[model samples]
Target: MQPTPLATSPMPDSEMLRLRQEFVDASWWLTLVYALISSALLPARAWLLGSWRLSDSIIFLFIAGYLLAFGQRRRLGGWWRDSPPVLVMMLGGSTGLLGNGLLGSGLMTLIFANTLVAVLFGRRVVWIAFLYTMGVVLLAAWLYASGRLPPRVSSDYSSSPLAWLMAISSGTLMSFLVLHFVSLYRQRVEALHERLRVQSEEIARLAHHDELTGLPSLRLARDRLRMACHQAERQRSKAALLFIDLDGFKRINDSAGHEAGDEVLRVVAARMVEAVRSVDTVARLGGDEFIVILSGVPDARTATEVAQKIVAAAAAPIPWQGCTLQIGASIGIALYPEHSDTPEDLLRRADSAMYSVKRGGKNGYALHEEPRTPGHTCQPC
Candidate 1:
């Protein structure tokens, strides 16, 4: 089987929309976690330091600001949703300035910020965020080296070393947990997209093909017929429509089971395919009725030869169930611009000619001749 276009193309619109919603929901939940963690760490920082430090104050304000921004996200649009990376970067800088320099809380914050950026905006944005974070770390190192930034603790008050360790460790653990789950969600989304792509291809195949004989269905045949007519009109050539009906299909179907009937039909379908060229179209139009589109037919003789080949192929015996089954086909030929210009009219004329052959005798083919009057019947040759 050929590879479907859906299999090769990019992710469809529905999948993109679903992924966007998933990212938005993940960001919201992550922000909520950030708010809760900050709330828990606020009192601990004040207790350990014996007073509220600039970093502690910033964390408190961030908790409130993040909540407010999330609440107004719909009004603020994408900017509100994208503000977390910048907010976290600010928090990291403040903590680094208040705590140790680049080695302590600052380094941990940068790592967590990079993870958040990856989860929120994917790989392309993470690199930009990473460079910005490195710049901040270098700036912090220079300030500390120049003696402009204060030491880890103020000279007047001493803080517990364990407090700094607990803050950094807890934040790192939370960020890691969020990153792990985000990765899992992305994998799940990819799997779902693959399943949807397979289903879409199957649906497209079924819509254009017949289930029994593996031939083009009636709908696809009509489309091809219309396209062939347009091409013939452009090239100033003639196209022929051949309508075929099995002579004793109903009798075989009624005598034997549907399984046998299906086998016979498949055999007939195969024969019809062998009779046509690569560019010609052969389609099953339900039951025992089939249509063949012969493009660039120079004259009626070429069309008759193709119809005769189909008739002869159908007359061949098919071996089945320790017995030989026999059948015949009656075909009607209609030429474009001679019999009818439109696909519908051509089909009707061909069908009428096939009935004319059936009225004369089975196992024969006929060409549609123009009617003399509006009420006059079609004559077949």
Candidate 2:
């Protein structure tokens, strides 16, 4: 059977949708984590500072936002679907801006957010996120320079246990994000490589096998013939080449149609394989023609016996479409070191012998007889 071509297009819509849903679910988990972290920080800050600063209200707002986003995550659609990367990046950037500005965890948070976007979305979305981040940093820098915003003293929180806790928590989450996506990317690459390796093997198989009968093609047959001859030479034994032609195949093709003829050929090929020894090579030489290489044969007589089995196999009726299709095999065998030691000579002489059988009425086997003079002749077996 002919192999179906491998797909080279993007994933199907169902798969794409499923992947998007997974990302959506992951986003919800991220939101829930952020809310929990913020909630924990609120209590830690109240205990450390002895009183809640007014800026603590901003933390409350952020915590509420995270919780609300997490709750409504399943309902994310329309605008949420189209621009989740933008929404997520902005949320992360906002947290960094209000918590410590870009000088603190804000810068790191923004970078991680961009990386997250890069993983889920394409490069285009990542580029847009980068531009947005740069714009925010520049605006914040300008405001601080112009005295429009109060100067954030890094030393104010740098030595605080609360600041350290926040840093450790955020860093751990960001690192997990980086590692998770990195592992996913690696798995996808490995899967792709495996698919390519399998496809390469399939392409090689199709190249050297018959599409119709799934038997070895002429190229593979020739390679086997050469190896058989070489092995026979080393072992000081005999090898034989059998050339087979299906009798009345043209008549079947013309009368019943090519489909029926193909079925017949497939059946014949299977029968021929069953008739030969497991070590022997049975190959198709295209359209109603096949070749068998019998390795390490004792004599021409052994080759003849194998050919006789093949003839009996082919002579059996093949059932197709509620009708019995009758066919026969005309076999010609030539031995190595006796007829000719070379694969080329053995194939040529066997083919000549097969034609001799066809000319002398088909459905029989012949042994190649080398011409003593100019003309060639085949000795019927």
lDDT of each: 0.75, 0.75
Best by TM-score: 2
Clashing pairs in 1: none
What is the per-residue lDDT of model 1 for residues 1-381, given as tens digits with 9 covering 90 to 100? 122243344455666655555666665666567566657766765675577777677777777777777677766656566656447555745575446664445576566666667655766677887787777777777888889886655443335555455555556655755676667667767877787778887778778988778889889999999988998899889899999999888888788767778899899999999998999999999899999999988888898889889988999998889997888998888999788989999999999888877876777788886311112344534
Instruction: Give the clash total for candidate 1.
Output: 0
For model 2, what is the error of residue 37's alpha carbon versus the real structure, in angstroms, after optimal superposition? Answer: 6.6
Distance from true location, Cα of 258 in model 1, Å: 1.3
Q: Model 2's lDDT to the true fold?
A: 0.75
Q: How close is each model in CA RMSD to the real structure?
A: 10.6, 5.9
Pairs of residues clashing in candidate 2: none
Q: Which window of 10 residues has the lowest lDDT sum in candidate 2?
A: 370-379
